[model samples]
Target: MESSSEFPTSPSSGTTAITNPGFPVSDTVLSGASLPSPPERTSSQGGGIPLSKTASNVSSHSHRQSFAENQRHPPPSPRTQRHPSFTQQAIQDLMNHPPPNRHQNPRYVGRDWRDVAVGELLQPDEVKWAELDMSIQEATKTLFQSSPNNVVLVRQDSSSKEAMSTFDHSDLNAYLLAVVGLAKPEEEQVALYRDISVKAQSQEEIPLRDLQPIFRKEELVKIPAESTLDKAIEVFGGGVHRILVTNKDSEVVGILSQLRLLEFFWNEAVNFPLIDRLYTIVLRDLQIGTQQIIAVNADAPLADALFLMSSEGLTSVAVVDNGHNVVGNISTVDVRHLTNANSLPLLKASCMHFISVILSERGVEHGRDSFPVFYVNPYSTLAHTVAKLVATQSHRMWVVESASPSPSAPATPLLQASSSLPPLSTLSPPAISPGRTGSPTPGSATVVVPPPGAITTSTPQSPSTQGPFSSVPASALPGAGLSGRLTGVVSLTDILNLFAKSSGLRPLDPSEQRARRRRSSSSSVRPTLDIGRENGRGSVDSRR
Candidate 1:
């Protein structure tokens, strides 16, 4: 059952400064949302699965498991500082060349990031496609997508010396994509999501299971359904654009996402205190999604999901069970099969526990929904909510419709499961009877993707440096392993694509291509043939 001891928030205490590991800290700090992991074998000893980002060591912290048993969550870690010099220089370089567009500028006076979406900020070229996990798309009946936020330039050589590094704004987009779900994590790439959520309660690092999970009790900001825009302005301060439309049960009926208020007050409305205009920005006005939800079964392949995201566009998607209530969601670049689906029978002993924990969380299944998921009671405070998000470094949450719906048998052992995510057995597809249109819709199909090749992914111990992978060219990887799971190395090609798009430097058209007769060609500048939609809207849009 949900708790009803309403905990409402007061205004924020504002930003505070804190120190990082050698990095200067300010009140405006950010961190990763990941979980802890078990011990890892050193890469130097032999070929082992690369570490998951959120890995940790567990043997010393037996007492900590009880903390997690109590539902205390972990906190996400701040971005790591262990990058080579090249990576650092790249970041500084991007800071130097800022976008000129008022809408695209990250630091425009009075502008807040939460208030905007990529559609408003992205150039035509800037909008690259990403794949959605099958669960997210099928559960929501929408193609989920995100644009890259940042692109880091890493230079590695045989001598093990770091080369010149640069960070481009484009890189930032890629980072955002990874953060939200537009990009996929490399297989064995360890990322700490909520460093705090699954970390040892003690200050020192510990194994994932040993982390004392803390679910804080904090006040939240709640808006009554009847509250007016003018009234909301007085309460939320400068950026309170919209309010949540909730019912008497405190269930959200709709919301006034910031975009809602912007449409009404864009250029013409009187400039009132933003808090005041908040209430009237109804959920109906701000709904950025469509009515028809498209979804795939949880077992579906991520490649299928990515095809959906890249072709369709999505921000976040709702995961649903057979009953159709939303359970979870997946976003951005975290949906890679390499990192999330390495079925090595037993994960690499060298692969750290924290990263595995993150991997487990990243690919969790909520009943049958395709998206990864996490949960909280309906009554947690906003502060509690924020704490949970901060701890896990995940932006979305799942408030199970029924708090005491079901309980499971006590966990028997660790080997029974890889990470802490529920074993795949519990996941099942949502049930939807077919409409007159056709074959079984997305929900009817099984979306299970084949697990990745052996998790102890390493090349054969041959004299030549080329590993087993080198022996099998991407084209001959049996199925889709090569193109689908190649984040192991970052190439200049990916970086080039990122920069060109951010700058809106498009290529020529087919006619233009022929006329110039040049060497290089552009993606946006393509041989134009109609790849119009199956829907007839393409024939006569007045906007065109």
Candidate 2:
């Protein structure tokens, strides 16, 4: 296997705009580049109006009271004690001593806010892959072991710069659906063979080309090696998740991923006091993570939702109603319940069919229960947002509002969690039917929930009792619902972006900008997250 590759720090070349319909135009552009007009928005889409920075005075008062009350009496939970001390300490150190050259990419030197380049934030990409000839089962297993994010790169030469044939996460899923019977089959024998031979031999012969999108040179969006991180973020602003980074020869040097960018932002926020300093910030002030809501109707088959997420490279998708009311959310974390078990019977079935089996079958798994989606209001302060994220221990929160009912009838309040419900500890993980022969029984195989919430807090008797940053008690988020409809999303990554942008909100003194420029010129390589060493431990598990 190849080790992580490094590239030169030269300034990136030209900037390119994303053509995806879902994204907004970036606020900043490369020097001399004309800023593209932002796409217009419909009310349902939540884009037209400028986000308000000032929280209502009443909201301020209520927030103050809530904070004071929490300071007076803190709640107790097992999660707090389990937080990795190294993570906490590293953040604290970063807060006190932010590196003089905090920006990781050096290509941004001499650049103003509008001229800021995307290359500054670019890092050597880390992604998983499988050749087309590999079996699905083998690829899936190898992918999860090293890269739990579970989106594998299907390529002939994954690192190749030239025309690369590919199939994404969605293709793998669509294929699974076909083989398992939800999707129509091309031929009876092919389907039957897949069912028998695939399960029996654990391999398949078809190349990935059958499912790959037609390769077009223009389809592969590339950026020069020296483009600013701002340009990259703008490219992402168009809902493009990953972009190809290239050198003068147009040879691919690295891949920039939205997930990596978000991770970088989150890590930076933790290292700095930006969260506290910018407590008054609102959703309007920062770049929302996902431009268009990658949503599915609540009534849609779970298979459909999975396919959407897989195709979009999203871990979760909002479950909405015909009226566009955000109802619930389903993510990879929920999918884990099925994937962890002997899911031969469920893998190919509609989500409804599979959900039924889990709810009604035997051998109940401890942590595989389904749960409602957690949300935040668009008008809520960043302080409140961060509080909810920390309190719930969540990676992302849905932003929604109560939609106006039709003119024909009286309005009704949006759905709310009942205060009378029992504690989470009382809820059991749903049951699922046993697996085929050789499948691990509930007692034999240890199952772990995947992504966003994969960081385990404790060895629980039941997994359903908690989720990655599950619902914050209603009391904890007092007045969060006052803000209106689903506008945009603010994830842990957005929080980091806010911190990064906050630095640019005020123009740097020429002296300060010059100092930064000098620092960038002298910087050799950016510091890396040395997980094992940082934690003073050796094994990955120990670091966790």
Candidate 3:
């Protein structure tokens, strides 16, 4: 893993001495927020995954298992000394890149969501599209080579007379599609959607439209181009992970994403501190503390896992046993490699099946049993949050039950029955009853429950018992192979949202507020650090 010292430094700082390429200046100091004392950095063996604690004289199979786990999450080894303060050059560099058109620039300025218009930072051009009749194989190729966004917009073939008009407001519903990928540990490939079918022994071309998942208009999170950033944040905090920015015509123009927003705030936090002090804040004081835990069963089909992630706009999901104990976790990246040219089962296979396959392929008995899981107590400080993200290069961490009823007995596992959903092919057509216009109205689709034992998952034991996974000691696995009940999740996006809502950069004065109002009347105004939100007008308007 890259050392924190290796973190990229701002290019603007001229006077700050360069210690090394990745390390920040060690002795530089500034003033404003009360910075906490730096904690001693410890060295671990893996990058993100926890290591297995096998006995030194373990079997060759145990050695291979240990080796595989380290490959996935290599422990860290200390490389550089910790820096005590921000360099003068770094501070000066930040000052030079002042936020556009601010009424006042303080040593620390808290910016609000309303100040910037959605149009200014909009990225409509990033949306990738495919033809309605395009083959799933072709779409997968397009996504792997050119698109990084999660969803693909499917449009009618250009050869048709009305191809251009197919993008009209009404057509938005028809174009929404999500891609699914591999959901097992140790497995890696380009990502593809769950509904795309590939025969077990042969590659068949499936129509992209056939695999498109229909989501209702109301189910989507959207914000007007004229809405404030705070409004976008409001929607995000309300459980909408991604917000589609629409114009006056209600056409989707761009997307305001949680991850991107969080990244922006993290950059600001590093650059815009009012004082030299590292601000001390805890999760209990942030918005993320109140979020409810969302998890999936360990034996759920890989397709279901992908659907939940794409619909909720999450990068990862926690895997829980029937007792609600988190057994593992799967992220978008974990499943990304499934797009490989190899013939592998996807939609119909359970997550455990994928893990088992990966293990078998790697000559390891079972990798899933030892997959690393990390958790943080809700009351943990933001400092620790930043530290973990940096140290592990991970996207998010789980908030687990701080105290368990019994260490021997794991916390309540997710009910095994929850994994009973069938492959996307078997899911009853979304319950879109016919409407007044004689067309099916786009809305919630109730899935028909299958009979008991109809949908089954692979058992915890591997089909092969001769492998090393069988001989490894139980203590070698993460959290003793049992996770506490999940309480919440904190991602890089959540951290940024908290910072955007909390960082008090500078207060707006009456005269400055009046100037803002005057400017807003003529043009869109970016948010400033104004706390007043009286009478629902918000601080951006005339300070109520």
Give the winner by lDDT.
3
Query: What does candidate 3 score in Cα RMSD to the true structure?
Result: 18.5
For residues 156-187, could you state the per-residue lDDT of candidate 3 as single tens digits? 76433211111111111111222212221111
Model number with the top TM-score: 3
lDDT by residue (1-544, candidate 1, tens digit) is 0010101112225411111112111111122112222234332223223454565674434423454444444332222212213422332232222222314223333543233322232233321121211222121111111212221211232222221121222222222223223233223322332222122112232221211111010112234444443333322222221233444554333434333333223321222233223223322232211123443322232222332432233222333322333323333333321221222221112111212222232222211101112343333332233333333333233443232222110110111222222222122212223541111222222222222232433322211111111121112212111111110111111122222232333312222322222211111111111112222111211110
**TM-score per candidate:** 0.25, 0.42, 0.44
Flag the better candidate by TM-score, 2 or 3: 3
Residue-level lDDT of model 2, residues 1-544, one tens digit each, is 0000011112124412111111111111101111122234323322223445776544434334354565565554332233223433343233234334645334323334334344555455544556666554455444444332334555565554442423333344444444333332234334342443244233334444433321110123456656655555544443444556666675555666655565444344434343335655665465454434555543344556665544334545654443334444555544433332234333333332332232221112211221122455555555555544443334466676432221011111111112132211122223323552211111111112222213446431311212211222211222222223444466654554444455553221223322332232122222211112122222211110
Better of 1 and 3 by lDDT: 3
lDDT of each: 0.25, 0.38, 0.39
lDDT (Cα, 0-100) at 495 in candidate 2: 56
State the TM-score for model 2: 0.42
Cand. 1 Cα-lDDT: 0.25
Clashes of each: 103, 19, 50
